[model samples]
Target: PLAAREASRVGAHRDAAGHYEVALRYSDALPMEGQAALHEGHAFECHLIGRIDAAMEAQGEARRLWQALGDRLKEGDSLRCLSRFAYLVGDRAAADRFGVQAVELLETAPDSAELAMAYSNLSQLAMLAERLDETLSLGAKAVGLAERLNRPDILCHALNNVGAAGQWLDFAKGRRDLARSLGIALAGNFQEHAARAFTNCACVEMNRLNLNEAEAFLDRGIAYCVENDLATWRDYMRGVQAQLLLRRGLWNEAATIAHDVVDDEATTALVRYPSLVALARLRIRRGDPSAGPVLDEMKRFLDKGMELQRLAPYAAVMAELAWLGQGDRAEALRLIDLAESRSPTRAVVGELATWRQFLSPDSDPGEIDGMAEPHRLLLAGDWRGAAAFWARIDAPFERALALLQGDEAAQREALDIFEGLGARPVAQHVRGLMRQSGVSHIARGPRQATRTNLAGLTQRQMEVLQLIERGFSNKKIAAHLTISPKTVDHHVSAVLEKLEAVSRGEATAAARASGLL
Candidate 1:
């Protein structure tokens, strides 16, 4: 029992679970309190490995034992464990009941660590429900309590919850808090907390379009999960890696990764939902007629009232599939409306707005600027105008879509860009169009540098450099780009490294010399 408890504490979940099962077989020989403690340890290990049914069963037994012994604190801890299990299994109603009961029981208890944990569980529940403000408040309380108690475990969980809440409220502060949480977890050898922090930080970077940084974080996260036998987190990181692949336009690889996640029977619905949508989107972009089934599956999840945070991106992708693949203008409009209603962030709203305009030209999409301008022009039936706008923005995919309606020379140019980006599915679609047109030996036109330049800076890095040259500070640049300052810092570092410069001024000068500014 002690070995099982120690293993669980150190994040050796699989070994802990094994030892727990062995101990449970002889638990009848132990005293009531020992039996209760053993069951609780088993429950926690089971929960860590995503064995929801086993966790709930063990925790229920533990709770019953503790109650029989009149141990309110241990019973409350069991309730908190049950709450987390319920939340993971998507039973938010049950989770809230358990969470509230735990908090109420622990409120008057002298154990600050336990009380902090109760608050952290409540905060996590709030986060899942999209109650960001409540999450922040509860998480702050938990953090304060944990810090006062000097409990590393509770502190790590509280910090992660608070940082995640901040991500939706203020990106700069969120990134900093998440980074600090990761540092603390690592320094304290809290493997589970460190893995979770890595995943959250990578998600932030991914949202900011910092693909390189996101990948780096994901790599570390995946390694940690593998080393510790964290099955659920490993799968979750794989799903995130698939998302990064999709953003990079690696269609074949992305589809494969998403397919694996969706097809795995062991995978939870929370992870499978996004993977299914990603797979469906890739299929639609690849011109596959079979994408309809995938879309239908994703729609079923949406209809079940998934959390708004997940629904936003799912609805946006469904809108695109409806418009582009199914030709269901009405459905497209409805999905876009859903996307807008669920999206809490400006970046997501802008993306959905771009799709909304594509489906309904008469609908005012507000100021047409940035990446969406070309899309709006395309929707207005100004193919040449859209193409020109895309070319100016250096957006090859939009340019390709625009040229699909006209301009064979420009279409070939767009194809070259897709091919260079390893966007196999998109390139294949473009190639089919080229073959149908019987175009050959097209004249080369002036093109912006590909994603990678002679100076080895990515397109995003080049944009950051340009903004820096325009005298924008990191915070201002983050606001301008709708990314986090941490992401801006990453870009600045990359720019400096690639230019072999020691300062921002020197980096800007080097970029200008390389004709990148």
Candidate 2:
């Protein structure tokens, strides 16, 4: 037990689990309480190492032992562990049942850390289930109790749940709470809590479209997880990273990371969720035939829980795929209805609304307050505005989508961008639209190598290179492109890097040499 504790203290989770297993082998010599403690310790280590089955079995044993010994507090602690394990394994019903039982059992005990944790557990479950009001109430109780007890870990746990959920209603207040939780975890050297804090912080930034901030948090979180041997959190953070890359228009890198995480057999559903979303969205855009199977696999996650985060993304993906003139539009509409009814956060509503726009192009979505910027622009039928925003953020795919909402000239430009990105699925759809609209003399898209661009320059970057070749300054390019100089600067830097050049002159030379001019 001492060895296990020491190993866990140093972040050697696998070693801790092994030590706990050895201790448990001889635990029969100990009293009931000692045996239960061993089981609980082993379960925690197993949980950290992503051994859900072993964690559940050990926690169950601990729960039974505590129940037999008439220790309600210990039993409740075990139940909370079981609840967490169940949730990680995508058994939402079982998780909810275990959490409720845990809270009920702990309520009968005196004020303690265990009871606070029970409240936090239920709070987390409520948040994931999108019961925001219940989430806040339970989280408040947990936070209050944890504060009074001076339990930093419990406080961090409660704040994380409440803060993330609170963002749906109030972004600033939620961010403050999340920041506070992260501060506490860092100060206390709570490695697991810190990893979670980093993950949640990244998630919040990503939700608000603060791509730079999100990337910073992801970098720190992934590094911390690697240092601490937190494979599960590492994988979850990696999945989120893939999503961020997808949003940033780094599709090939995003697809690679997503596929790596999703294809790994040991990944839990929780870790797989975001990566699967990235993969499905990417494949759908590229018109990959395997997209259907990927989307179907994502759908199976809903059988575990109908959380807004899950439902909204799934609905948006399905809606877009359906709008591409495939799949069942009716089913996609049904999902949109369900997501809007559950938790209509502006981000969710905006995403669903943007996709829903295509399903019924004539139906104006009107104006929505606090809608995300790109969605707001799209909803207002300002394709240029939307495209400019995506360009500033370096999201070429979304910019292309935005351009598709414009006239023949804009649509032709959109087709060029899609072809440049190797988005054949959407490119074909655009070609069909052009044929219908009687736009003649369409240029054949870039060859396979050109579409995949040997220099790895995006369409926007290619345009920036052409302007550079004309000896246009960043300021001039920004004015010509209707974007900010800062954005132009960013594109210039990316172009220079991709061409492996030290100056604009060298970049132009490299572009000419590679026939990208």
Candidate 3:
């Protein structure tokens, strides 16, 4: 047992698990209390190493032993562990039952870490199940108890759950709580809790469209995980990174990350779900037939749980596919209605509402605070407002979606963006919409060019390419060309795409090699 403690203390979780197993083999020689404690320790070690079954078995043994010893406090704590293990395995019903039982048992016990953990676990479950009011209520109880008990681990755990849940309902309070949780975990060297804090912070920031801040958290969290061999957390953060990349219009890089996670057989569902969503969304945007298999696979995950985290993204894509006349409209609406029934905060509901509008334009998406600015504007029939907001954020895809509802000129601009982003289905849909509106002289896109010469650069694109080659900034290029900065951005993007280059320098090099410069 001492050896196991030392191993865990050093962050050697696999070694710690092995040492705990060795200690458990001779547990018959110890008292009942000692034996139960060893089992609990072994269970935690196993969990850290991603051995869910082993963790559950060990924790069950501990629970039985505590019950036999008439130790309700320890038994309740063991049950809490079992609840978490069940949730990780996608047995939500079993998780809820165990968590409730644990909380009931602990409620009669004295103020303790065991009881605090029970509250925290129940709160976390409530949050994941989209019971926002219950989550905050229970989370507050747990945090208050943990603070009074002066238990950093319990406090950090409670804070993370509450903070993440709070972001949906109260953005400012959520950020403060998450910041506090992160600080306490870091100061105490609680590596796992710290990693979780980093992941949650990044997720919230990404959803809020604060990409730079999200990237910073991901970088630090990934480094910490790598240093500590936290494979589970590392993979989970990588999934968030993939989603972040997708939101930033870097589909190629996003696809690479998402595909890697989806292809790895060893990944846990918690880590795989987000990556699957990212990949499926990307494939849908590109009009790939392969998106069918990806979405089909996602259906299996949806069967596991109906958490907003899972339901929102899947439904959003299905809503888009339905809008494109390639999916079941009724089913998409059903899913969106179900997600809305969860009473999600503004950001999530706002997204669902946007999709709802696409499918059923007359449906009301009631006023929601904290909705992403662009989506709120879009839902309110302020297409120009939404497009301007998306442009300010540099989110071209969403900007295009907003512009698609505008006048003919705006629709043409939207088509240009979709084409540039390689969103073939959306671009084609935009073209169809234009034709239906009796718009004429629609572009057929740029013509193909030979390997030599300017590689099919338009006069404007060639000018942008030249400025890029000369190390001119976008602002400087815009000034020289006497065009709006937005126009300059479009031309710069076109030049890079035409040259098949990933960066300004590479675009210039490709242009020079093709004798276009």
Candidate 4:
């Protein structure tokens, strides 16, 4: 039954629910103990897919059915599931009370896995309630209990929760703990566990400036959630990924990702809209010229966020946009000063400080400490670090912007770096700029994409994408490749449509995502 329920998580949600409904029917037809067990599984599947009201209904029926049958263990399981549901919906106080009763009722039961579920729920509740001190005090005990019983899911949750709660830990110590948690999560085959660990690792690595690794890990995490059909977290990770891209300087791509994420059905925008503001800030930063609509959209978003939830992050964004677009130095100062009045966590305080320094360059360091390791790598003239950071963030424009700023020899070097990483569009743009700068063949190193794994590309299509990536317009490409400009136009549309791109910037990103460039 666990295996079947877990299977439904992979594809066709309604199909999965149908299977559970059938399972529930059979359980009702079976003996007392069988009926008790079946309802537990049914309620679990209900909760997994966000049918919270249905879940609570099923669980209530399970409790009544189990109590009537004199099934103490099944009754306890239903109560624990209720506690999980309550905790999920932000009822930490009731969750803790129900959870303790669950453990007490199950003391003589042999279901170690079920027992671990309750513990995991308790651990998560503690984390969400900001009982970090209590979490640390109780976390090791939970780990010991889970390990002694050999419950992998409980162990995974504990390890990940420890890392989440450890955000307040000292930097060096936090990194070591998060890295260890990531290793354990990767070792586990559970998709949810892997997603949790990878996302946690992305956060730590972002703080440490390991941009390349952060991007890679986040991709793995987001992909895992998508594949696992974890819709709620899939939406949450979308916000995280967009923020990384915006920070890396891929404004349009960031906006596109933000566009999909902000509409995800399962999440509220308390965390999500701040991400939109970041993208809006980027549109403003790149001097997009046609950003008037987006700015108004952002202001409306901020206003809505303020009404829905009083989040400090949204307020920080008001400052960010002021700094990015209006150049209202005094206004920016006033906004940040106002932000300090709210409870400034690391994200608010750190980003508020960093964005200001990034723009002014001459602004006082204030207490930012330093850029994330990835940002530092890009800033410190490390080609490999810059490549890795930009790739993780998938920020092709930023990578190109830096390449454009480089001297001739440096441009060639940057070109080689992008080319090597399959950044075809960016490398093409660089080559076009180099030609305009009048330094085409005067440089060294291989810009040739060298026939590697063409993967899914047709020979003619590959030729066209390569040319377009190299910054050749339809006329130049048609002239060089002996095709009509009309044919070149036709081929470009084919490539963009096939790549699922909505714009040129998006096309470059799609190439990167597909490993085509």
Candidate 5:
């Protein structure tokens, strides 16, 4: 079993599986205590291979074996791992119950480090279940336990939860907590863990509209990641860097980097959504509604999963959905709330939540008090207001949004802007796309088919068609145009006939494509 586990650790998958099988067969002849250890090892290997169901089975068997051997601590650890597997498989209620049992059994265990695992798992479970209040309470408990344990690895895990708890607090509170976590992580001497901590700090800064601080923290983290050869960190840092570029108005660079990042194999689906959404927004800003389809793609991804993947990117998708006139503007807000509740002390979700609240109809966006506000203002379609607001930020993401939203002729000019900002990857990406076969610089999609123009439509008919395109309910349109809902229906039929569109969304897309909007 030990050989199998070590082989698995060394990445010899086939060899490890064979060795695990051999261990299982040999364990059939051993005492229950020996068998439990063997089965526990087998289950651990199964987990490492992503055979989650098999892992559960092995874990169950191991728990029985451990119980027979009277090894309560091993049984508790096995239960905790199994509970996490169940949670991952959509059995949260079961996970919750098992988690409580795991902790109860661990209560008198003298090893603080072992006990910290149970605490961390419980905290994670609370966060995943969207119990924000529970998340904070559990997070606090986990951090205290990890501190008492005084183990670096355990401390790293606890700091993550602390950051998450702070994430739910308002700006100053979130910042103070993440900074303290940062100091602890740096003191722990795990470069990768410290890098992650720095990234979280950047998120808090981003949320507070402190772009300068965010940029500095993100840059430092990325540099650390590069130095450490951490694949996961590199991918994450790139995503954060891409967003900051867009914030800074480094349009071409942000878009270009976003384009590249989306295709990186190391990028998770969580990373994929944000990169694409950012790219899609850039396309929209570039005066291309083709982003409509891209935004739809992101919305679909947002609906798929939760867990570590459910936080930052999901909120970005929800915000885009609302912006694009998907029904239930509140769905976006609801998702933001969910992400905030479920994620541990992380920067992206909290910061994005802050930004979303700032941009919300119910709040004063200016409370964020950053140069990013100009773009927030520009979201209502005021280019000049945003352009003047651009100088206050030096972020790449804002520039990418600017280039995307800028006039087509101005895109070339924006390329120089990206180069000036030292974002060569982005500039190189855009320059590489200077020409493409069968691609339109300006997208002209099914535009009511110039062949089927609305020439014969009367004034009243045009009003109805516009309302329909705007997603107005028939009753609502009737009130707007001072006509009966039935009368509005007749106008919609006539407009669809003239435009040859099958649905109001199609008609609206056509109308916008034809410059009617």
Candidate 6:
């Protein structure tokens, strides 16, 4: 029992499973509670190693044993585990059933830790179902209980669920909660909890368009998972890394990593879908003929019933594919409506508005009044204005999309940016546009040096510059990038010197004006 417990504590899941199995062989000679505990331990190890069938079997036995022993608390714990397992397998109905049962069982239980965990599980289920208000309420209860009980693990789980749900509902609170959870997990040496905290924090950064900070967090997460032999989380972080790469206009690298994730047989549907979406987006952006088939695959996945939390992203991507690839305005509008129905958060609404504009350039601009700057301009039929706005924001892909709707000169500028970023697919599309416009003598030579040459800046320096542009303080940047404040200071100094600016704001403005952003 001690060996099994130690193995499980250190994340040696397979070894723990073996030890638990050996202990279970002598179950008849053990006490009822001991037998139930052995089965529960075996179930957890199996679940960790992706043996879902075995885990379910063991957990069912454990739950039955707990019930026979009249241990409501242990039964509630088993139900919570089952709830998580059902959720992992994409069975929301079963997950809800188990979670509700767990909560009911724990309501009268005196053990604050068990009750806290039960509430946490229910909160996670609520989040997955897109019940944001319910998620926050349940998470608050879980947090209060865990704090009173002094249970760090329950608190971490509650914080993660609430923080993730808050990202779409309340950004500032989400960031604070996720950051606090990360600090607690790190200080407590809770490897799994820390990994989840890192992932949630990265998602928050991505939402804020702080791609560099998101990438840094993902890198740390990947390293931590590898060091601890966490195969599932490693794959999930790789998917997120692919997403960050895609956003940075590194299409080839993004496609390679995304394909690896999609091809991994061990990955769950939840982990695989984002990678698939990234790959499809990359293919479509590059104007690949294969994009149609990928979009079809996404449609099939949607038909299989995705979690409500993922519906908005899936619908947003489909809206783009419908507009750009199929040229079906009606289908695109339907997808946009679907996305808005799912979340209607700022990001989703903005993306939907952009797709609507792309589909119908003559549409009423007033319909998208509260959209983001670039989307608002694009929807208003000011393609050139949108291009300039995105360029000023250092969003090259968006700038290119805006420019694609403009005149020859704008197309030429967009092509230059695309080629400079090594976006071969987008550059090919731009070249085709040039050919169709009867502008034959296209200059395909190496790019000329600009007046504001940012080539002097290293990758790290560029990351620092972006954070600086986002108004992150030196300490905040250091924390986000996982570097010493002293290192951040040096990077900031180098960025200022390379940009030839007197202050951070001046450097940001200079970079934007020079098109070196």
Give residue 59's error in model 4 in angstroms. Answer: 4.3
Highest lDDT, which number? 2
lDDT of 2: 0.85
Q: What TM-score do all the candidates reach, one by one? A: 0.72, 0.85, 0.82, 0.57, 0.53, 0.76
Give the per-residue Cα lDDT of candidate 3 at 419.
78
lDDT of each residue in 325-345, candidate 5, tens digit only:
432567767777776566544
Clashing pairs in 2: none
Steric overlap count per candidate: 0, 0, 0, 7, 24, 0
Model 6 lDDT vs. the true structure?
A: 0.75
Better of 2 and 6 by lDDT: 2
Q: In candidate 4, which residue pairs clash?
A: 208-373, 209-372, 209-373, 209-374, 422-517, 428-469, 428-470
Worst 10 residues of 3 by lDDT: 445-454
After superposition on all CA atoms, what RMSD does each candidate show versus the true structure? Answer: 13.8, 9.9, 9.7, 10.9, 14.5, 11.6
Off by over 4 Å in 2: 364-367, 446-517
lDDT of 2 by residue, 458-515 (tens): 8888778766654456876797688999999999999999889999888867775675
Better of 3 and 5 by lDDT: 3
Rank candidates, TM-score, best first. Answer: 2, 3, 6, 1, 4, 5
* lDDT score for residue 278 of model 5: 64
Q: Write the per-residue lDDT of candidate 3 for residues 1-517, one digit (tens) a residue.
A: 8888887776788888899898888889899999999999998887766677888999999999999999999899999999998887667788999999999998897888999989999999998877878888999899899989889888998898889888987889999999999999988878778988999899889878888899999999989877766666777788888888777777766776776666677666766878888877887887656678779877887787777888888899899899888999999999998888776655677888898888898887877556888888888789999999888867788889899889988999999888777676787787887998899999765432432244777767766775565445687678767899999988888887878999987886676565463
Task: Report the poorest 10 consecutive residues by lDDT, candidate 2.
Answer: 443-452
- Once superposed on the true structure, which residue ranges of model 3 sit more than 4 Å away at CA? 21-35, 445-517
